[model samples]
Target: MSGRIPHVIRRVGAVVGRLSVYVLIWAGLALLMATAVIRFYWGEITVGQMLLNLVSVETDGGGGPIVWIGVLAIGVLPLLLTVGIAALWQHVRRRERRRRGHDVRPRRSQWVKRTVATALVGAVVVGGTTAFATTVGIGDYIAAGNSKYDLGDYYVEPSVTGAEHRRNLVLIYLESGEATLADDQLFEKDAFAPLKEVTEAADGWQSVADLQQTQGGGWTMAGLTSTQCGVPLKGVGSAAGNGALHELGGEDSYLGGVTCLGDVLDEHGYRSVFLGGANASFAAKDVFLGSHGYSEVKDLSDWRAAGEPEQSFRDDWGLSDGRLMAHAKDEVDELHAEAERTGQPFNLTVLTLDTHEPVHVYDYCTVDTQNVVTSVFFCSMTQVAGFVDHMQEKGYLDDTAVVIVGDHLKHMSAGDAFHEQLDHHDNRTVFNRIWVPGEDGNSTLRPRVDQLNMYPTILEAAGMTLQDRAAGLGVSAFAPDVPAGSAQAMAPEAYADLLGSRSARFYAEAWAGGDAAR
Candidate 1:
């Protein structure tokens, strides 16, 4: 009866073990399939590409079929070996159990019992650790918490204030113009010499932090969008989509997602221009530009007759920043005359192209990929300097409240590490600075300002009335009492609300047939 009981117990254990195996296998398969489907459809992963990435770690080099087969083999090998080892160990333990009493053990090392006891203790410790981990909701909770910031904390409600100097706004969104000092070593680096010289000489050229685009990357469209829209590129939440730009002439879509500086300027009867080096058609540019109230747009097709070469198109983009500025200078001159005739200030925009990615050509510096990307950043600064010089020569510098800033910091390139053993605090944020012409000496503003606040600053500088609370998000250098760190710029959600409210108002007005085009 004792032997029969042992056999019955062994049989029951085998059945339970097999059932657990099947259950685990099914659960794993279901989880894999669900993840695959999500990645395929909503995440926009193609069938072929999905399989390829699964089988091959990187598709950069060749070996398509073989690479995939190797991937499968490597993934499965460890599991198979583990299973085999477990089965063998179980078989040995079962023999020992059958041969001896239920409490029987195999011959082992001197410390084997102690080791097993320690492992059991370790398992208890691991179980507690796992419970704590699950309770904490570790990584995702931390990230989401960090991204959250309150507007009330930063923007205290205050009264509206008036300003002087209502000049025509000409915001030249010079592509990638980071206000950095020039370096002597690199070529193609002289672009920003004009800005450097001017800022150095002028006592009023104040600098603030760079505009941080949401993703820390360049889409050109995103940069322009953030600049004009005065919000981070992402999280436009619940905004209207005007329509497709494929059929519309010029800009086809209504840029409803962002609160635009254009609408504000347009409210003041300033005709805004959206000009750039990228094609007018690229990446919803036409719709974003048009819907955001750019009265005139000059992209690649517009520059065809400017005697720019077919190979100069090999500038691998639209027009050079230098060329774009020259064209913009001409456009500004025309708009100035027209504004004089109509008694309306012209809002000119020249989105420059030269200092963008590949940072190949600048007036002063160039960098090899082997060096740090900040080496190339120096090139962008030089280009800005040169552009500023040109603007000054053409009288675009005087009395015109100019705002030049980087769309975002340069993303560090691969294999190019900043290996200096500097103090940890010294290497914190990589955002660039904002340069407000003639507003430098104001002590009321904080030492650090962010990118999104730039829109209000421009509006305030150009003589628009802003609430003291709204102005808390920004400071007018022209204002007598500027509080240090009084305004800390918009966080992502507040920024979203700011943009959405303005954009919705624009759409609502446009729908009602009042100031829609404006």
Candidate 2:
């Protein structure tokens, strides 16, 4: 029976020894496969990327399945090694006893053998740890983990120049108003020449769009979202699913929204006005604006009341930019005059349709409809030039800050000019033009602005105190400069959260305010 027991133990020992070897090889191969996957996806994955990926700071307290798997693997390695080695040693001892019979006395050198075994195990462990650390840049990698940026620390300050009283803001968004388009010719310089002359001839302000997240193809909604949310558009699909629309609508209470901006304006005693191009019905313009505290809205149908037939039926999609501009000028004048009479300020938001699609104005244009749409863009520029010039003549320029920005990039059907101007993705470059009555000489600010920062920049210029939460992806042009790569501080998920949350809050508050008034 004793001999049989010894034989059984020996067999178990051999099996365990062989299993250990197989397990070790399996572990090594698994690690290699994982490394290969990382390399392929990242294009340049080093061991450091792997280690960094492991040290996630789980703020949500749910370590998740992946974390649990890692923890279990870490816990099992030592235990498996210890049990395998012990089984092997016991099997070898038993085999020797069975061979010599009568349990032959062990040698005094057993202590020495034990010491050597311990030393060897220690060496393997230390060597493995050192190798892992060195391959992954563990030290520097660990240091980088210390500087995590939270999405809650940003803010925007509202302070308009010379207007001690908080005033309602009117932001007019024109589509595809490239700097070149404002020029007399369809070529690049000609397109932008008028804007250049207007900005250059201004008293103290400088003009620069400082387009951000625009090295890629330009999309119109993407630009509008960036300006409205004070963050880049993220992605078109992302915008569709996320709170870019919801936040502007104020569906969530905490995330800031266009309503939040309106609320801020409301607190300063201003009403929000949203005027869409004649095609306000085409896009969900009325629904969106009405929810965002723009109680008064006038679109294409409204132009019909003024007996403007050409303006009323300009486009199947929307009104002509020329007519929209004309209406806006009249409305703004009325509002400004009313504010003057009542000791209050006004806020207005406008979306222009002149540059809508079908790149209409061709040198040898055959399509009449297309020509009107395209001509309206040029006319819109001329109109904007005249509008600013008119405001200057009326002396109201000193009291207002006029900002001309493109709502979205136009989707050209088939244009070589567009292909030449943008990348393969056809991203419309967001063109921003700002004229603050008196600060026209601030050249230091031209190169330092971004679309995401426009909200805070305007707010700061308008004299409102911005809370840290409002800082968002935008920085005040009046604020200090952040280093180039600092914008990428948050991971993609965190950034999406940052944009989504704020948008949700803005929309929720705006909707709530409108609801309360009703």
Structural similarity to truth (TM-score) of each candidate = 0.55, 0.55
- RMSD in Å for all candidates: 11.7, 16.7
Can you write out model 1's per-residue Cα lDDT over 1-518, one digit (the tens) per residue?
Answer: 98999999999998897556544433343334333333222222222222212322322112123334444443454346436645765697687677666754456742585487456444544553443333322333234334444322343222336534567776656454433323334323443454556665245665543233433223344455445543434221112243312222333444453346676676667788866765665444566666666787777767776777654442455565555666766777787678768877767766655544444444333454454344545544455455566656766555465666555433222212232311222322223323444555544443344454555666765656776524323444334454544533445555544432323333333323233324
- Candidate 2 stretches with Cα past 4 Å from truth are 1-168, 180-189, 213-222, 231-260, 310-312, 360-376, 410-417, 424-429, 446-449, 467-470, 482-518
Model 1 root-mean-square deviation: 11.7
Q: Write the per-residue lDDT of candidate 2 for residues 341-424, one digit (tens) a residue.
A: 997777777776545543334232223223354344555566566666766676666777666676544443232244443434
The 10 consecutive residues of candidate 2 with the worst lDDT sum are 55-64
